[model samples]
Target: MFSADTEQWARDTFHHSELGDRRRSKRLVQLASSLANHLGQSLVQSLKSPADIEAAYRFTRNQAIDPQAIAEAGFAATVENTKHYECLLALEDTTSLEFSHSTVRGDMGHTTSNNYSRGMFAHSVLLFAPHEQHVVGLIEQERWTRNIKDYGKSQNHAKRPYLEKESYKCERASRAMETRLGEGMSKIISVCDREADLIEYLAYKTSNQQRFVVRSMQSRCILESEDKLYQYSASLTDAGMRTVQVRQKGGRKARRAVCEVRYAPITVKVPSNKKGEPVELYYVGCQEREQEKGLNWHILTSEPVRSKEEAERILDYYEKRWLIEEFHKAWKSGGTQVENLRMQSKENLERMVVILAFIAVRLHQLRYLGLNKEEAEKQSCEMILSPQSWKILWSKQEKRKPPKKAPSLYWAYINLGKLAGWYDSKRNGRVGWERLWEGWFILQTILEGYLLAKSLDL
Candidate 1:
């Protein structure tokens, strides 16, 4: 899904972009290549020469360059890669990109609970191959700003048209993916959090025959039974017990908890005021059997869950939804530092954000590959690093001559962590994206000097 060569990947992604002019398209490829090579660095730090830095700034400031056009190129590339996979999980979520700088804030809208804070909301649909255990690419990204004047309009949400509401982003993304993927739409199963439990959204998916596994938010009315959706779900027979590993969030410590699984097929009635038909779907309920703080999931799905294995598969699909959250962190703070961008105008800020979004996916992919021991051991380092890069990294880290044969990805993963000052111990947790990128940054800097010296033949 991703290439080892930064320049080649950039060219393949943005070369055919229709950005008004051929020169603009060429500049997009060059700028993306430079940014991808540098990973987390800012524009001034990423571009080696002053001319390149100035060109980058100029490219962003161009009014003719549509941010959506830039993003569409990458989306097209992702759709092409989806052809190889038999099944994919399309994870959707929204994140706030806050730019609180005085110069840029006025150009943006309010974010989170703070009216004083200004930013834009980026809703992304990231494609992942479940069998491969790797991110394919970002197929859809919608960037928008909330009007500051409408800060206190929550009470009027029901009165507003569905198209005008913020929640429409999810449905819009689904439509975009369907149009883009065309015949490949059947291969994808949409996975989303509680925010996507809207009846309109679910109805759209079900009516279109789009498969989905969305966490239940509303205890909806059931057509056949007197009990509501959750009540009916609780009354179903317990299928079995399964242990699930919980990731640490906030102050919670990581631990495994046994959960009781229950599943049933139910027909959900549309709300009284809303004009829609009752939607029939499968429901899977998972609650921790014991523990003060435990895992509980009220999952709603279009996929059939007739047996324990099928119910577990639904649970696993929802669990992978956390990848989008980690991706947001990688984009905003961890890897890309997109929020740190100092573009003076909203247009330029969005232009840079779209470009960096792809880079963040690459960073997420690298960390994923490093963590999977089996996959890393089976593949060669050449899948991620250039010949000169692995050879140089080998010579520098091992304090010996470079080997003629390439090393395993596991070897490169461990040594990269070491270069970033990570202590290799079972007591220490897995290497994070930050540390992996730090090691990569150091290697790239050294590779630059090595290539320079070789060019001089000194």
Candidate 2:
């Protein structure tokens, strides 16, 4: 989605990467191009030549190559893209990457209390253009392996310094974005889940004048009032009713939930244990009026929520928070399958994961392109697939000569699902990421063959 060809896009994305040596930066671009072209595949399968694969290993194993430098180039590219938009939603969340292989287990930390389960945690901030309803790119990401000894220290969280806590990742990312975006920081509205409701994090955002909509996890005391934050919110008059699409989680079926919206301005007092001043913020509450156990959202935001429309807008921004979760799935299990890596060293693993993280974002962008049927139909498939790629795909799917003009993105998207053995029927709804990437894999294979044939003039 960034460019017409994956190789050129990789160059544009990583050419400026400060990887110590110029050759290393070039190798990074080449490696990223190869990985991007054959996404969701293992290293051996993705790299075309044995020499290229060996070079990739050497690049990652190089002690001087910093993983953060590789990731920073991508973040730089994303920041440049963000400049074009007037406003964007910065969706932030954390996910774990677990490696169960015996070879890599020793280098990793425990993902859970089970010492055998080894992995690292990745906290990412994915930028989205709310107006366009599409992903921009990953602005900030932090990957760290947990100390195995600290696996059972949840009870001692409060005693630990704020910077040492895992929750600090969110605030750290915000600071990074602020540094990177500079003047553009005002254009961003950070949308986060309940985990970001920490008093320190909220206070930091408020002090920095960073606009945000965070789901409330705890009801802190209200300044100059007897009622707690949630209790005060409940007492406000119902502003209006909003119909929201509740996504399916586990056994719960996806359905529409009509929620009663209530909002008010409140000043939250810092707990006696904390050292921050009282922060004034708006609280937006949504209680489902239909189902007994329907969606209930307690939204706390720095944005103004004076009217019903403003309150609903805050909820909309909060709802976009799901995109980050989907992004994590795409990075870990759905598409890239980063956990499948068998790198022997944590350094090598970190380098590889940093590269694959960008590929996962590209995969997510491709799938997101087709989500809005109307917009997909109007847009050309060239927005994603290259001319050679789409032409071959069209010929294969239509069983005829390729069209002179590129087809609609929706047509390409649907047919890609068909290529991956998806049956279009009333029973089957929209095509998922698995099928979409499967289709992309098949198409890439065909495109390679076509290019080879044209090279030989056969």
Top model number, lDDT: 1
* Root-mean-square deviation of every model: 1.4, 1.5
Model 2 per-residue lDDT tens digits across residues 316-410: 89898888888887788778889998888999899999999998898888878877788999999998888888888888889999978899998
Error of 1 at 95 (Å): 0.6
Which stretches of candidate 2 lie above 4 Å from their native place? 425-429
lDDT (Cα atoms) of all candidates against the true structure: 0.89, 0.87
lDDT of 1 by residue, 1-458 (tens): 66789999898877758998998999999999888888788899999899999999999999989999999999998988898899999999999999867778888988878778899999999999998897999999999988899887867999998888999898999999999999899999999999899999999999999999999998999885898887787778999998888888789888888999999888889999898999999989999968666788899999998998999999999999989998997897778889888888999999999999998988788777877888889999998899999998899899998888899988888788778898767654377777777888888899999889999996
TM-score of each: 0.97, 0.97
Model 1, stretches more than 4 Å misplaced? 425-429
Least lDDT summed over 10 consecutive residues: which range in candidate 1? Answer: 424-433
